[model samples]
Target: MSRVGKKPIALPGGVKLQIGEELQVEGPKGKLLVPIPKGITIENKNGTVEVTRESDKYAALHGLTRALASNAIVGVSSGWTRELDIVGIGYRCDVKGNLATFTLGYSHSIEFLLPQGVDMTVDKQTHIVLKSHDRQLVGQVAAKMRALRPPDPYKNKGVRYTGEVLRKKVGKSGAGGKGK
Candidate 1:
């Protein structure tokens, strides 16, 4: 028995969910499509959604599907957000319309094209806020942006998520090598 799968997903006002071959979620934020895998059945109740598995092998997917559906519902209703912070000298970011320009101490700035329905905002050039109704898209965009300049373990300089902690490495003491 999956506790999460057994739980009903409460539907908030303004958000409409259609359960079928795929989950169609629409709300103020935007529209999102969540694929319904085989062997999983969705039951729409009074202002709630439920999931059931067609076989025991799909037991794991039962909860996963339900969780993803819940996330989609909430995302479309209130949206999702991911934040990134630029570290090190000259590390910064700028958003222009649907594109984001980044300068992670590199010689040239990098430009990232944003997909539709996603919004990005930069604060103080170091803090970036990404917003999207689709949870997957938001996560993917954030991951791509972070991958542009992953934080280095040595210097801990690069792009990282806000509130993300990094384990900084300690430099070796001055000791001449070459067998002394």
Candidate 2:
């Protein structure tokens, strides 16, 4: 038995679940659908939801289905957030409506369009906050933003996640006098 699959997910207030070919989770924030794989079953008892697999052959999918369902419930109920910071002398970002303009030390500024489900806010032109009811969408948006100008190992400049630690690499100037 998969431990994660056997655990019951508590349905918070304002969240509703519809089980069929797929699981439809709706709440105050938004709605999400989790696909139900073969040999896996879900049941709602009282305010809790449980996932069970038909046999050990579906062990791997058991945990995955449970996690997806749990995330959907939580996402619709409370939402999700992903934060990023722009690090550099001139690196910054601005969000106007559904468009985001980024100055990531490139010759020309990069313009990114926010997806329908994701929302972004900029603070002091350096801090970026991404919010959405879909956890995967929020994470994907953040990753794409970070990829625009990944942090430099030597200068430590570019977009990075909040509280992310990076070990700065020593530049050529720090190398011993081999060129001298």
Candidate 3:
């Protein structure tokens, strides 16, 4: 038996869950759907939810179901946030409504259109805050934004996650060349 699968997820106030082919969790923040895989079953008892498997063959699915359900529950209840920072002398980020304009020392500024479920805010013109009701979407959006200009190993300049540690690579020195 999976330890995570055996644990019951406590339902918070104003949150409701529906179990079917997909688990639908509705709460104050928003609603999230967690697809239920085959050989796994979910039960809602009292104020908690539990995931179970039909047999040992479904051990993986059991844990997966529980994790997805838990994420959905938490997502709908409190939502998720991902923060990013732009590092450079002239790099900056600006958010106007659903559009975000990034000036990463590029010849032309990059304009990124945010998706429906994701909301972005910029602070200090270099910090980005991405919020979403779905944890997966939050991570995906952050990754896409980071991919725009990943941190350079040698310069450590680009978009990076908050608190992300980067190792700076040493630049080459011509003094190492043989006497000419």
Candidate 4:
């Protein structure tokens, strides 16, 4: 038995769940659908939902289904958020409407368009906040932003997640190493 699958997910207020061929989770924030694989069953008892597998052959699906369902429920209810910080002398970002303009120390500024269902906000010209009801979408957007200007190991400049730790690499000692 999968421990994660056996656990019950508590349904928060203002959230509605429908169990069928697929699970539909709807709440104040948004709606999400979780696919149900064969040999796996989901049930709602009272206000909690439970996932069970018919046999050990479906062990992997059992846990996966449970996690997806949980994420959907939480997403629709309270939504998700991801934060990033631009680290450089001239690196900054600005969001106007659905478009984002980034100055990541390059010769020309990069313009990125925000996808539907994802919202972005900038603070202090360096901090970026991404929000969405879909957890996966929020994570994907954050990754794309970070990839635009990945942190440099030596100078530690570029985009990075807040509170993320990086070990700065030491530069060249001098030009007199092993010189006769």
Candidate lDDT scores, in order, read: 0.89, 0.94, 0.92, 0.94
Candidate 3: segments with Cα more than 4 A from true spot: 174-176
Taking all chains together, the TM-score of candidate 2 against the true structure is: 0.96
Query: Stretches of candidate 4 above 4 Å error?
Result: 176-180
Tens digit of per-residue lDDT, candidate 3, span 1-180: 898889999988889988888998999889888999889989999999989898999998898889889988888889999999999999999999999999998899999999989999899999999999899998999999999999999999999999999999999978786886
**Candidate 3 structure lDDT:** 0.92
Please provide, for model 2 over 144-174, each residue's C-alpha lDDT reduced to its tens digit, 9 standing for 90 to 100. Answer: 9999999999999999999999999977766
Put down candidate 1 lDDT per residue, 1-180, tens digits, no spaces.
888888989999998878778999999887888889999999888888889987789989999999899999999899899998999988888888997888887789999999997899888999999998888888999999999999999999999999998999888877758674
What does the lDDT read for residue 33 in candidate 1? Answer: 86
Candidate 2 stretches with Cα past 4 Å from truth are 174-180
- Arranged by lDDT, best first: 2, 4, 3, 1
Which pairs clash in the backbone of model 3? Answer: none
Q: Give candidate 1's error at residue 150 in angstroms.
A: 0.8
Candidate 4 residue 102 Cα shift, in angstroms, is 0.4
Q: How many clashes in each structure?
A: 0, 0, 0, 0
Quantify how close model 2 is to the true structure by its C-alpha RMSD in Å: 1.5
Off by over 4 Å in 1: 178-180
